[model samples]
Structure formats: structure tokens, C-alpha cells
Target: MQSAELQGILPGKLIHMLNLMRFNFNVRFISVLSLVN
Candidate 1:
């Protein structure tokens, strides 16, 4: 939900792409962490 909001506010420029990429990376990281726990 929060990630989706961030994506909406961000532009499609290079920096925004990086932001979205980082957001995706964080989501994946959290999912993996939860599975590990």
C-alpha cells in the first residue's frame, strides 16, 4: 500500500526509476526476512 503511494507520486525520470527500484528491493528484502524468521 505504502509502496504503491510512493510509486504514484514519483515521476518516470531516472531518479524516480531508482526510487521505485529501491522500493521494490525493500519489499523483497522484507518478504525474505519474514520467511527466514
Candidate 2:
């Protein structure tokens, strides 16, 4: 496959991974914030 094709797929996969990480982190943060409030 071409480099461009790999790059195109990479961002989607990276974004999904990032979103999952963000979701987990956000949930933890929200819970902590609620406790502190």
C-alpha cells in the first residue's frame, strides 16, 4: 500500500485510541471533581 493510504488509516485508528483514553480519563476526572465539590 502507499504511504498516503497508511497515513489515512493511521489517523482514524489513532483518533479512536485517543478517544478511548480520553473517555476513561474524563470519567475519572469527573468522579474526582464531584468528590471535591
Give the per-residue lDDT digits (tens) of candidate 2, residues 1-37.
6999999999999999999999999999999999999
Stretches of candidate 1 off by over 4 Å are 1-12
Q: How does candidate 1 fare on TM-score? A: 0.66
How many backbone overlaps does candidate 2 show? Answer: 0
Please identify model 2 stretches exceeding 4 Å from their true place.
1-5
lDDT of each: 0.87, 0.98
Model 1 weakest 10-residue run by lDDT:
5-14
Per-residue lDDT of candidate 1, residues 1-36 (tens digit): 999877876655667789899999999999999999
TM-score per candidate, chains pooled: 0.66, 0.61
